[model samples]
Target: MKYLNALRNQWIAARGWMFCTLLLAGLLIYVMQSYVQLSANMPTRLVPYDLHLMEGPVEVGASAGYTDEDYLTEIAVADTQLHSTWTPNNVESQYARFQNRMTPALYAKVGNDLQGRLPDLENSERSQALFVEHTEALEDTVRVTGRLRAWIGSEQVEDRPIAYRVRYAFSDGVPYVAGFSVEEE
Candidate 1:
């Protein structure tokens, strides 16, 4: 009777201890799961980008070669930059006209060409570059042929428009005139 009573008491103690441990473990798991769900539902804060600018020679222009769109863009820019407003009366106006249209090296060459003609500058008018045709000479070079109309203030300078071809290159990271030639066509 004593051995049987001791065995029953030990079994009862072991069962009670196991039940208490299981209850504690379930509570701990529930608490941890609820904390995770609550944090996930909260709104997250976003961080902004930090872009600090530095000073240097601002790199300009597209790459050496051109896509179809790039080729058209260079042609348009070159036309605008090259079109000259004929300043017939003043040396300052003539110089300024070339200075505006041509690059530094180009200006040096064309300036000499126009230097002696400043006195007769008023004999001409502003040139309107009406684009006619373009041919890609190289990967980065374009030969643009166009009709050049001269307008003196409000009047046309001639009865017929002049045809001109300009060889332009974007090889040096910028679209610039390589050569200018006039044609009767």
Candidate 2:
């Protein structure tokens, strides 16, 4: 007991070593807590919650990979019911000249139409179940191939099947389609 008391008295006489030991222990605890939090928040895989963002919709142009000729041909073939004298060559020239002339109204109309169809395509319970099961297997970029039919004035214009590939960036748990292109199938 006398020896232990002597050692304690000597250690207390110095004081600096004891303070340093306490500070180091506190620092170690703080570092360990930060490490745990960082590991907890790290992403394990790409999920829908990782993709939904509210950036403005992108525009489609000739440089988007579809040639003027291709766009003209698609428009013409789709608008067979229209009795216009406009030819594919003429439309191609117009599109070539106005490649950068995308209007907000045009994009809005396309987005509205797409939104309307999404309920039918994406809201099915069966499809959702399938999506849940195999979503990991789906590519980050998706290629959607479909045809669009719209009524222009009194004419029923059925556009040919156009395959579009869209690259999506996942944000906020939803996949937002960011860029699009027409693919030749």
Candidate 3:
């Protein structure tokens, strides 16, 4: 009876603290329940624009059945766009992004070569933009032809025809860049 009395007295003294603890626990439960409801109501598949920079259907990686001419054309255009568009300040970032689309072997060869050119590109203050003229998709290869406009410190330096042919290796329809060649026309 004495021990119970002591515990009762202590609990009375700590009632304010207990009330705060209970309030916080209730708030935490409410927040968690609200989160669960919100998550449950959310869509399972997000729209393409939500996850990608370009607006189109959400691509769920490459598939053998889906590797059609249209797919090759899309890949070619995207590759060339990343390859040919760069400013002095953005060249490094652009190349880094481009690396994601290449095979390990290709990246090892090209990436090291690109690193060597980075200092020159940075120092030159050059920018280049491409306007696509034509794109042809063939078996295992895609060619993108465009007009390339170069600028040196806001002054237009050169504008000419450029073409890039990218060869791809597909393993079960997942494209990995094998190699590429550039031609000036």
TM-scores, one per candidate: 0.41, 0.26, 0.67
Error of 3 at 166 (Å): 0.8
Residue 48, candidate 1: alpha-carbon lDDT: 24
lDDT of 3 at 85: 92
Cα RMSD to native, each candidate?
22.7, 18.6, 7.3
Candidate 2 lDDT over 1-185, as tens digits, reads 99999999998977988899899999999999999999999986523332457264322332343223333333323222121112332433333222222234433545455435444433332111000111111234444444434333446554444455444443443333344455544
Candidate 3 at 181: error in angstroms? 0.9
Q: Which ten residues in a row have the lowest lDDT in candidate 1?
A: 45-54
Q: Candidate 2: deviation at residue 175, Å?
A: 1.7
Per-residue lDDT of candidate 3, residues 1-185 (tens digit):
99999999999879978999999999999999999999999967534434557565544334443445766788888888887899988888877777888888899888888778888987887999989989987777888998999998889999999999998887644787888889878
> What's the best-to-worst order under TM-score?
3, 1, 2
Cα lDDT for residue 132, model 2? 10
lDDT of each: 0.55, 0.41, 0.82
**Clashing residue pairs found in predicted model 3:** none
Q: Which residue ranges in model 3 land beyond 4 Å of their true spot?
A: 1-66
Better of 2 and 3 by lDDT: 3
Clashes of each: 2, 12, 0
Query: Which residue pairs show backbone clashes in model 1?
Result: 88-121, 88-122
